[model samples]
Target: MISFIWSPGNPLPAGTGGSENYTVGQVRELTRRGVPAQVVTVGLGTDDGRDDFVDIPFLSLPTLAAVGALDGTVVFVNEPHPVPTRRPAFLILHNPPPIREQHRAFAIEGTRDRALIATSRYAASLWSSYLDVDVSTINVVYPFAEPCFAAQARPDNRTGTTRVLFAGRLSPEKGIYTLLETLHIDVIEQDVALTFTATTAGADKPQGKIIERLLREHPAITVVTTRRTPASMAALMTEHDIVVMPSNSQYWHETFGIVSIEAQHSGCRVIASDDGGLPETDCGGVLLIAPDNAETLAWGIRAAIDSGPLSLSARRYAGMRFTVEQSVDTLLTVFAQPQPSPPATIIRQLEELILAPSVEAAHTVRVPTGTTA
Candidate 1:
């Protein structure tokens, strides 16, 4: 039996974004495998809004504390708890914990800012160097893909050379600027069109400088700022042939990219930045490009587009790599980790993780480094 005490990305099932998608995907995978999986979330998230995944009563976060404790709970959280203490718990960190100056999270729980939430060796190195702690403790569970294959391929309604799409928050750190600026004059010159999809908050925010740059230069590319319901997002992704990720953030590394997985499950090739946890997305047929470089991104995009048969290959590759059944299998392994016999093992470990020495660092806060961070 595996269950999570989680807070949604925004509490609004659909609009809340990536973390919610993760929670739903994880829960669906586990339960389908016959493991009991529960998510402790906010009140029907009614005040927050709704999504296909967040609409149910089971996903609700209980207001009572005792109920949370009764279940052999595994706390799968995106952020650090301000108050640190132990009850049977395992944390699923979305952002790498900071190892620098103390921030607000220290108030909730005594968790190391630079604590390891590694899904790979490269990520482990970043945590050790940045947080000054042993990286071994960070769990290395590769993120699971969204579980919907309802989005089958379709004929391109727009006509001309068929193309896939990249949809997400278009920010400078997200590498949209790099991809748009560096695409070959010939490639940009091509009749290939683009539809950049992002939610309303990102559209309204000041962070969209990269998107602004893309719009200013590429008239052929259309920038879409409309928010989609969960069904809409699934439909949109399935309709396209490729999904592009051009992240170029200096500090905000993508911990795990669900968008890449969504694209893959929907039978789309994913062109992504070769940074952070994106390489793990390789398991799903993601074509990696150097971070912060536009020429490379454009080159990657063009290559995926030109291969003609690459889209079908990528879709098949992703299907082999990611599955709800495999995701559940991994979770069962995490849950069966010999449950520290000493009983207080978790409490003791938290003590050490919290006490690790701090260092001078960049922004210690973890925000939107990836789809669910």
Candidate 2:
């Protein structure tokens, strides 16, 4: 039996975000393989958000403290929490953990037995360096785009206006400000038609209002601020010639750009920032731009428009490389490995990982390189 522990009270696949999509894909793939997969919702009741996955609800986190493990059971946790089970658990880290507070997690005692999994090689390296854990112990499991994002037939580019789409968060960290700057440049040049799909609402209402104002003022730009179903998003992606991902590395090294993969799957060429794991998604199909650079983004956008739609080879590569089956197979292999009990020294370091206040604090107070807290 396999179990996954996600955020408390939230529905499986909490949002259209990469991690949520991955969780739903994992569960569905596991079930397709005849594995008895279950999800432990850490809180009572389900939220409004939902996905089309095989939902299996089990006990919550608060109740796990007194529970005993079942033989042949394996658990995978996607969020930061005190280890919930002794049944050969694996901590699947979707993002970089809080830098300084990591040591406190080690003190939880339960985490000492859980193995680690990172979504990308870059993420694995970053976390291994940060947690003082042996890189060999951390498996790299690349997430696949949902099947809904499969390649679609593109509109004839012979005489059509170039359509560029940006499907992600409307926040500064996502490089939204840089994207806005690019749009301004594009509009002034009158080079290509633009559409911005803000997948999730911004952290603040002010940002949303600013984006609304920008959309209202720009005659050449269209904005999609509502959430769409996976199918709807895939269909929407097909209507565009290029997709933009200008994530800023200063605030957060985008652990993995799932939307970039999805865009490729929809046969859209990608204009991405070379931030964190963004380069890995290139697959010879991306136009790379420096993070937080609006001029370069504008140039890349115009370049993509000049180049025309994505080629068949690039689309095929993305479809074949970033499939749910491939990712699930790799993950299942890692899941089969015997769980290792970390040593006392490493456990001490992990405790620091949980306890450290922040990345800056970890660098200044403990590990000079901020590699290990």
**Most accurate candidate by TM-score:** 2
- Point out where model 1 deviates above 4 Å: 1-3, 7-17, 42-70, 82-86, 98-100, 104-109, 112-121, 128-133, 156-158, 183-187, 190-201, 204-218, 225-231, 311-314, 339-373
- Against the true structure, candidate 1 has what lDDT? 0.58
Off by over 4 Å in 2: 13-15, 48-76, 99-112, 155-159, 186-189, 192-197, 200-220, 225-228, 343-373
Model 2 lDDT tens row, 225-321 = 4444566778778887888899987868877888888889889989999888888887556888989999998888878877877778878777777
| Best model number under lDDT | 2
C-alpha lDDT values of all predictions: 0.58, 0.70
Worst-scoring 10-residue span by lDDT in model 2: 45-54
Q: Cα deviation in Å at residue 361, candidate 2?
A: 46
Report the lDDT of model 1 for residue 252: 71
Error of 2 at 319 (Å): 1.0
